[model samples]
Target: MTSPIQQPSRRAVLRMVAGAPLLLGASAALAVATSAPALAAQAGWRWCERCSGLWYSLNGTRGTCPAGNVFDGGHHSNGSGNYILKTVEDGGRGQGNWRWCGACQGLWYGGNPTLGYCPNRGATGHTPIGPYPTISSYYLIEDVGNRDSPGGQEQWRWCYKCAGMFFDGNTPGGSGRCPKDGYTHSVTGGSYVLRQVP
Candidate 1:
């Protein structure tokens, strides 16, 4: 992507194409009404919305660019499918790093903030948590036999020690224990605690 200064003036270029009013910060509809020359508005341009490094005038109602873009549409996002934007390429750090706002579903730049991605970016891991053989202190439920999702008839547990999953509550490949005999699962983060059933 081109840097802000290197970017061509939106108005100058637009005028050559269709003679749209160069609102000098004036929005096509709401472009700043400053009466500045179109070239000036395009020169010190700032983005209205944020994502994938795209920006538009703060004045206009939202709409897609001639180029196909998802956020360009008026519809806002929940930031479930967000990405990063930077003045620097290849995820590099610099004075301009953007964080996708899950609420606005837009990119916010100019803050030089810590780098982060939205949770919907698949940040969770699928690591095996526990195969606990004996009851756990944190959990307080009776153990029920393992259950499986539909379309199958099998369940597995993870051995916290061996760091492997085992079948039928076996301790094989695991060091974690199934709570004594009357425990239920109480999951936290990526781990589970066995709770005694009332």
Candidate 2:
């Protein structure tokens, strides 16, 4: 037979009253944790293992790589780390005038009068869609200092050799290909950090 239920002692009742705040605090903390927004990231940008340049990989065609002949004369993305580029829509913290080359599918700096080199489009420079000043659709990339934020992949630098952005992370394979110099890309200027898609 079950024992008769006994009323809680005064000490037990007092202890529960004291612990109520702790329970409420835990519940509030949990609600905040669940309500926080998840980190957002942009995708479709990738490192070309063959050309050492950053290229947009969302197209039906893989686009040309200076290294050449890897996959149907296109950029090789094998072993590439997926990168998320910050666009102008995100904020104005980064630089703009970065445009995608339709001819080669690589990112080129269009701020200068010179459009930069394009392997697929010959030495005449990359053939980007849209007119001068403001390209129809331009991409803005963030330039970061030595200290990178959480999930920010550093070691990306500008290649004076190709006038393109390439990954120079401590890759054992060495800096990827550079079409202009017909060799690995040479990093110059400050290091850039690209946000890695989590």
Candidate 3:
């Protein structure tokens, strides 16, 4: 005759029931992380102390700056902080159409039908750094208007005069120098935040 099957002990049943919630929670966390959009970030973008404009510093040649230079008339990065820029390919959580200008090495908006003003290009407009279709378009996250991102530096704005991104975080109510304008860069758009690359 076959023996009857034994039932699990009361203690064993209680242990599994207690651990069920923990296992489920872990699975939920993993799912959320995997479903999130991927963010690609590049460091070496920096603020220009002289012109107060944002520029890419990874290149060997420093592009022209609106503010004249002592040596080569290029962008002066003295005491400037290195910033990290993120590109979300899926159009996630930020403003798009931001592009790197090869002509001046400054970041400018590329969405306009007419190319915006470029100090280096002399009214021709800023040139995108890379070739067509392969050019990198960046997404800038606004740090203003109820979006408080404490991890990045705030008060960075788009210059209406130059159509280039510039820093307005100076003391005593002074905006950084503008290349297009003889004086400071005029802020008109959203306040953007850029994380300093440590």
Candidate 4:
């Protein structure tokens, strides 16, 4: 005698159908959570007016600023609003020096005070005491691909007297005269020499 074929009970089939939507929703949520961090790694920088701070965004989506205002993509400066927007190239590929400014409490480009003051503060003095414990720190960004030799890239430093950034490699031992302040500061060593690695 042949065995009779069996089917799923009607209740079992109905239970599975009822759970389908919940299963799909869970899967979607998992997908988003898993991908968020990866997206954030690739996101560039953004500036927020409300918080007067810089932020990062992934695929143009960012959380509300601390002050609850939206972020601005391009550079912007609003004196009345007391906010400014700027972007720093990812340190992945660049040749320059970064320094810590005690006055502005932020990192600045070049070794001198002349490359303009920090984002928050006005201009300050650039002394040649090899980075000062009171104000400046050593933050250098050297281009591995291009050394400061022959036809390679030149070393840069900030000049406080001139209030501008200057190439120090042109002079011997990275000691160059400031256009406005004359010969004073050395662009080689400073207080904290903090090196940033990519």
Candidate 5:
């Protein structure tokens, strides 16, 4: 009998060739597994040497993606706290929470973590006090050409059914406000004059 290696049968060789895909696929998967972490480090995906999984950084400096936190439209307050802001949807899981209108990018990197207020991306200060004609608190904003530095203006409004106040840093004066348009409040009589945030 000829040696198996020296005289391999055509059928055996064909089987080996047919199995090549499985072997190659396994090798490719292994390569990806070994290389993924490096890519995460190089490609700017969120990484936590201390963290277990994917994360985020506004300026690629810091942000956390904890195991319990959800990704889409959520936030990594500081390099740890995860607050999935609900502005994009209806009242964040119905708990009634609002997010600051600042750039979320800076909010994590430049986060004070001390103050009750957190700044958005690249923001150096808190919301300024100014005047406007209407506000929505949603509903984003559009300055076109104003002067607080760049953007436009912001403010908070009273909501009835939600029975709370939602701050709108995007829109100033709303087309309509609560009590002025049939919304109820506990106002004996108080006027909220425009006050600058000093």
Candidate 6:
């Protein structure tokens, strides 16, 4: 008679089979991590956006964005239809929050036309040119020659609710009601003095 044959335990066999997939997954993850540097090297440029500012780096050499945000793999839109993968030099003017004045075809600063005047029009006042967050704060001041003032520049108003700058043009003349917030004080009388940017 043959000696009793040895057999593997059922539990042991199951454990081995289950562990195979886990081992394979771990190996695959390791491979991807190891290849990441190579992929980054192949990348031509990278960009990062932060509350403080936008930044860029070449060939993956740049560090993380401010506040420890990771740099994205590609370029980002400047909200002006242009894809930017690098920081733009704006002389010493710094980045400006500007709005387009359609009537004058120029730009005004700080969203309030009354606070400042158009580039070419002196302090004639501003009209609601378009939506906020224009493409670029920088605009070419067009010489539209001399034309009648649009006559509806929003008066500088302060909203107690939003604590943001409100324009009188949004409401009827002499009314202090904010569009987003109910009645507030008009900071510029019914009108405001225009200060042009140099």
Please identify which of the two predictions, 4 or 5, would achieve the higher TM-score against the true structure. 4
Residues 1-198, model 3: lDDT tens digits: 010112232333445656666555666655534442222355678888778889888767578888865577888788988786665443456777888887788898777775677777877888875433346677787765533234668888988777889888787545877766578888886788777756
lDDT of 1 by residue, 59-166 (tens): 233322112245444422222122112223211112222222322222322232322222122122111111222211111111232211112112323222221121
Clashes of 5: 15
RMSD of each: 23.8, 16.2, 15.1, 20.7, 23.5, 26.5
TM-score of each: 0.17, 0.69, 0.73, 0.23, 0.17, 0.19
| Candidate 3 minimal-lDDT segment of 10 residues | 1-10
Q: Cα deviation in Å at residue 159, candidate 3?
A: 0.8
Model 6 Cα lDDT, one tens digit per residue, 1-198: 010112222333444656765555667545544431112111122112221112222222332221232334222313211111111112121223443343323223444435343222334543333343333232111112211122212233333232223334332333332222233432532332111211
Ranked by TM-score, the better of candidates 2 and 5 is 2
Could you tell me which 10 consecutive residues in candidate 4 have the lowest summed lDDT? 80-89
Kindly list the per-residue Cα lDDT of model 5 for residues 1-198, writing each as its tens digit. Answer: 011012233344445656665555666545544431111111122212221122224343343212124443333333332211212222111212222222222111112232222212122332211122221111112122322133222332333222223223222332122212232222221211111211
Candidate closest to the true structure, highest TM-score? 3
In lDDT terms, how accurate is model 6? 0.28
Q: Name the Cα RMSD for model 6.
A: 26.5
- Candidate ordering by lDDT (highest first): 3, 2, 4, 6, 5, 1
Q: Give the whole-model CA lDDT for all candidates, comma-separated.
A: 0.24, 0.63, 0.69, 0.31, 0.25, 0.28
Among the numbered candidates, top lDDT falls to 3
Clashes of each: 35, 0, 1, 13, 15, 1
Alpha carbon deviation, residue 134, candidate 2 (Å): 8.5
In angstroms, the error of model 2 at 104 is 0.7
